[model samples]
Target chain A: MANVLVNAPKTAKRGSIVEIKALILHPMETGFRPGPNGRIIPRNIIERFTATWNGTEIFDMEMSPAIAANPFVSFFAVASESGTVGLRWTGDEGFVVEERVAIAVE
Target chain B: MIARHFGIGLAIVFIASYALAQGMADKGGTDKRRSGTQDMGGVLQKMQDDDTANPGMLFVQLGGELWGKASGASGKSCADCHGSVASMKGVAARYPAIPKGADAPVDLEGRIDLCRTANQRAGSLTSESRELLALTAYVAHQSRGFPITPPDDPRLAPFRARGEKLWQARQGQLNLSCAICHDDNAGKKLAGVTIPEAHPTGYPIYRLEWQTLGSLKRRLRNCLAGIRAEPYAYDAPEYVMLDLFLMDRARGMMLESPGVRP
Candidate 1:
């Protein structure tokens, strides 16, 4: 599907508490299915996920197929001096997608 | 100005054609291993042989012991009500079966309810509860060696077809069909993890991540939520039908219930 989402306040002042939410779009398929010829389909899954803020990585995950499809992750990140909050998804395909949002410092 | 514009247009055309040619070449040159769906049998086999002793197996053992214990007003055990489970071997492979007068099939949880009401004289166990999972695992384990052969009777045809439809149905915000990822792109890595084919051979598994034993239906519910799809209630007919479809697809694959998995 799609990668996880990270949503938070677009702007925050230094020393403020902020809420961070991340959701990944995944099928988390168990890879036990077979093909038309009935050969066992091999397993392909996302092993890890990570998030960073202004070059400092904050949240990271080691995931399995059991984590389900499109995993939604939510947590908290303290608001320091605002910079760029970057989100990246690395999968078996290698670096599938990345997004960055500029956080305003008040 | 006109001459300059014409030159710019010719340059754009050249660049576009070159890019198109490069894309075609890349497609032919890309490594097949990078395409995903690589063989992982060795890894899976290793995991399977790693150990039979797991916390989930403990739950199954508890269920086996519970089968013989007397409970409820009848003071009768499952063994007393239904006879020896040995006689019922391979019965688990038949479940998620269509009940008489019902439009769809019933899962092991629902079947347990039938037993509770008809034989045990007890209330139905809540869906997704520990007791239900333990009993489901216990019963399914009885059919460990049996092939997953769903009935081919005429009455079952509609539900079986319906179940297959559900498997391929697209739902949720992502607009993804289960087959798209599970069937079409299976074995491709997403976020650094390999995507396993969607199979049901080893379920009611002990997930090291969850640190608890869980059923196939639980995993199904989680998948629905992950896709932003509204989940059917546990033991719901839709889920049963879906389970039947998945189980049939995993036919010939050995059962490894109470399996330990990451």
Candidate 2:
């Protein structure tokens, strides 16, 4: 279970700018910090985040170690039609989480 | 050196004021206590206020899932007996309660562990583990906005007394007690950070300093370490007693469990 959270309006006026909020729970560990045994912690971060509207990419972002734990991104997309907003986060260790939210355009 | 002397003199002044404040509290003229959230910047405050953005909600989500999903040898989940999480409202406000057939108080985590071993036939979750923290946050979230109302059982009186004594007594290499900071200097800045009047209205808090949810015991350990004092084990009775005293002190104050704090 990825424990992802997404907040977006269920209904929006067509051609209107709709705001979307997405968050995922991840440690986003940077390789620099040492553990209690004094060994460096391995770098493991969400590498990319993408949002799609009705299977077409609307926004994309590249993340690095600088991003804090539990990466959160908020963006806007135009409500052109009734469709699903799909969010995908890919990270180290073959980590992939995909979630979808439906919006009915009025 | 002169600096060391001045430090001791300042400590004495703090102690004197603390005693005076205690006297005032006894006489019912003490200053109103405020939550740590009041000391936070607006950005952080908003982060806590919004459930969608609040990181602690992630755990609460897990907790909600665990509540219904059956586990353990008995094949029972929390919902099997407790019904719905909504029924837990106002429950967190009255803990660290004295359980029946128990000599002392057990905080929420302790009670949950007891249930695991006794009723669910499951292993107890480790201290500060995600599952325990998640479950606690989920349960306590139900009590959000309800006033803290420590149970007034007669058996709790002694433990509460001991807790108050510990709260007032000076300890550590710096000879500082919880009172010197949270009592006498509350709302005053230390190293440019405001000292909140230590209240346990929130447990399983999502502290920005920790970058994760932590229990009241964890926060107490941090304070103990800051004062250069030896902290007890995570399951120490002293911690529960201290929790009881703090909650009693903050009686009538609203709970903000899964609270976000900077």
Candidate 3:
């Protein structure tokens, strides 16, 4: 398992903002880099990330090659009626990494 | 509601960006790029800082599993003989060291093969091997945060002396010595990139350039090639000698094995 670490308050007041932090393991390889033989290494990077609250999309964005390896992304969503907050990163060759954490609203 | 949500998300983005920049500046030192870990480009730094995000952790995790697996004619698992892996702290830092009765020093990789053949009766794995790298990284990971200490034994004198000479010796058509850049001009700009002091604080590091974990020899070979010189063979003694010298020279620096480098 490419370890994914995420932090979200276990309990939150309804309608309050809940911050989420996520870091995923990845090379985010850019094709512009040259190999030891001086050959250009093919680009391979996470192209998109989406965050959802119980199937309802809260935030999503397109990621480019410049984001760096092992991308660390943070975003906050209103703790409306929480179920599961999920983050998904889709990359080259249809690679997808997803993590989900549940939050309870008081 | 949607607009407010977007506003919070935007603020988070701004915070993340600020943290990213601040992380580099947070490293307090005259030279921020002293270790290989600090030399990483922006993205690579994030990869190395959080273990959850580093791809090299995959190998380290596998190595943890392999540590206790029995193999070869001896049917012995490494753990059976070595006991708790946690006890191995600070051992990797002392390697490329001379084993008892041996005239030459053996780096971690070499020692792995020695254990396999001599103790386990297992066949040797090839250089830059998946299993070998994983095991080496796993073993070395235990020593993370320990200082690299060159043993003061008199027997190691000649090899260290040879290594010292090689560091300053000019080579290749470019006729460049390792000192010219790594020592003399370290921290200065060269070809739009700041020259690093060439510390070996990390080894079996994951270089974004190669996109894989490589031993110190590979990095040395790269330097040789950069100088337009013929690189040594993978297992050459000269490489080992140079590695010994480099490790000793960088003694007392923190070990950051399985590091990420740009």
Q: Pick the candidate with the highest lDDT.
A: 2
lDDT of 1 at A45: 62
Please give, for every candidate in the order listed, the TM-score of chain B alone compared with the true chain B: 0.77, 0.87, 0.84
Model 2, residue B1: what's the lDDT? Answer: 100
User: In terms of DockQ, which candidate is strongest?
Assistant: 2
Tens-place lDDT per residue, model 3, B84-157, is 88977888898888887788988888988889888999889788887788788899999887778878878877
Clashes of each: 26, 0, 2
lDDT of 1 by residue, B67-105 (tens): 888767678889896777776677677666776667667
Q: How would you encode candidate 2's per-residue C-alpha lDDT over B107-185 as one tens digit per residue?
A: 9988888887788999889989988999999999999878789987999999999999999989999899999999998
Compose the digit string of candidate 3's lDDT tens values, residues A1-106.
Answer: 4546676788899999888878666778878989999999889899999999999999898989887776768789999885999889888977888889999988
Sorted by TM-score (best first), the order is 2, 3, 1
Off by over 4 Å in 1: A1-106, B1-52, B100-103
Q: Interface RMSD for candidate number 3?
A: 3.8
